[model samples]
Target: MMDTMFLKAALAVYFVSVLGYVTSIYVRRVMVAKVSTWIFFLAFLCHTISFIFRYLETGHTPVISIYETLSFFAWAMAGVYLAFQPKTKTRVLGAFVSPVTFLLMIAASKGLEGYVSIPEVLKSNLVPLHVILSVTGEALFALASFAGAMYLIQEGLIKNKKVSGFSRMLPSLSDLDRINHFCLMWGFPLLTLGVLVGSLWARTAWGSHWQWDPKQVWTLVAWVFYALLLHQRLAIGWKGHKAAFLSLLAFAILLVSLVAINLFFVTAHSFI
Candidate 1:
């Protein structure tokens, strides 16, 4: 019952956040941006409280079920936006970013009535830590992907000698590229930690660390791909569209790992 109420509240907050971003898109005044920021803050506060209530109701980390995973995804997405906006000063990205958060929150709200029942084998502290850090890292990568997509689009506009309007709203190409690079640098380590912890947990729970399960294999693939990107960025000083293209490819692989493995693959890790 409390979870249901929290879900409803989360949905409301998601809607308001989306509305605030939409308002930001049309309002040119500084006051409007400030106002939008406040609206986003309010929504974030509500979201936090809703998650807290969910935690209380579940008596554990609120990540046991697919519904809860979606909720966490929403939380991580908004957390990234809040953490990055001040640094990037890219209000225009909010117009795109907020909606994704809202959509995930809404999806989370859809299946909130189920009890969070962890599998007997998954009842360990490591599982929660792995999920939280992994989702948080993935959310950061998701934001980077959004920035990369925008960079590509804006770069295209520049190539075609088109500018102004939304094109003008974006930051310099170099700024987008820099931000994506920073996100990748920070996100990769966290993802690595999550993978390590998950492997440790697998060892304790199943007597094996690397089972080559679809999720595990795909996650390692993602880590390897990012590792290559980092190597190129360091050894070759890769940046600009080259780095952005790799970021885009990494995100595609992540989506496949997140969605395809769970939906189509028959494995213990297919928890979607």
Candidate 2:
């Protein structure tokens, strides 16, 4: 109940922050964006508190249900964005990030009834490591897609010579590209490690490292796709529009597959 209260508080603050960021974009006001970033940080703090309380209440990692998974994914997205702000000129990115965070929180809110009992197999210590790494990596991929989408918008505006005050508010193409590059550089390895850890857990619990379950199969597919994308990025000199387009494409496929796998088929990952 306490965690629910904190989650609701965070959601309300996230909504406000989303409004602030969107307002900053239209108003072309840097100060408004800065204030919105601070507001977003406050929301992140509230989300962190909520997660901690949920973990305490559940007596395990709070990622056992769809509600908790969405909550943690949103939290990871916020954290990843905030972490990048200090190192990059990404203040305007909150305009893209906040709306997604708010939507995820809204989805999470809808699924917040009933406590999920953790299965005995999921009680292993590796569960937290695997989930955190995989989810955080996915959060990074989400950011990369956001940046890619923004990059396309900025590119279109520039290419068509549609110079306007609104266009000026966006981050530079180079900056967006760098963010994409950074996320891919790190996200791939984290996701790879997550899959490896998950396999180890499978061995411990299911007596096999590879089950060929639909979730596992789809995850491998996503991993391979990103792996190739990352290779193209690092070795084949992929950047700019081509890289941005591929990033968006990859994430779109992954997102669609994730939803389809969860909804249309049964898998070990159905707990989320």
Return the TM-score for each candidate structure.
0.93, 0.95
lDDT tens digits, residue span 162-211, model 1 = 89666776778988987888889888988999889888998898799889
Model 2: per-residue Cα lDDT over 1-272, one tens digit each: 78888899999999999999999888888999999999999999999998898888878888767677888889999999999898987899899899999999999988775577777778888988888888899889999999999899999999999968567988899999999999988888998898899899889988999989887787787777788889998899999999999888878777865567888887876654
The collision pairs in model 1 are none
Task: Tally clashing residue pairs in candidate 1.
Answer: 0
Give the range of the ten consecutive residues with the poorest summed lDDT in model 2: 112-121
Q: Tell me the lDDT of model 1 at 53.
A: 79
Q: Which stretches of candidate 1 lie over 4 Å from their true place?
A: 26-31
Instruction: Provide the lowest-lDDT 10-residue window in model 1.
Output: 28-37
Quantify all predictions' global Cα lDDT against the true fold: 0.80, 0.88
Clash pairs for candidate 2: none
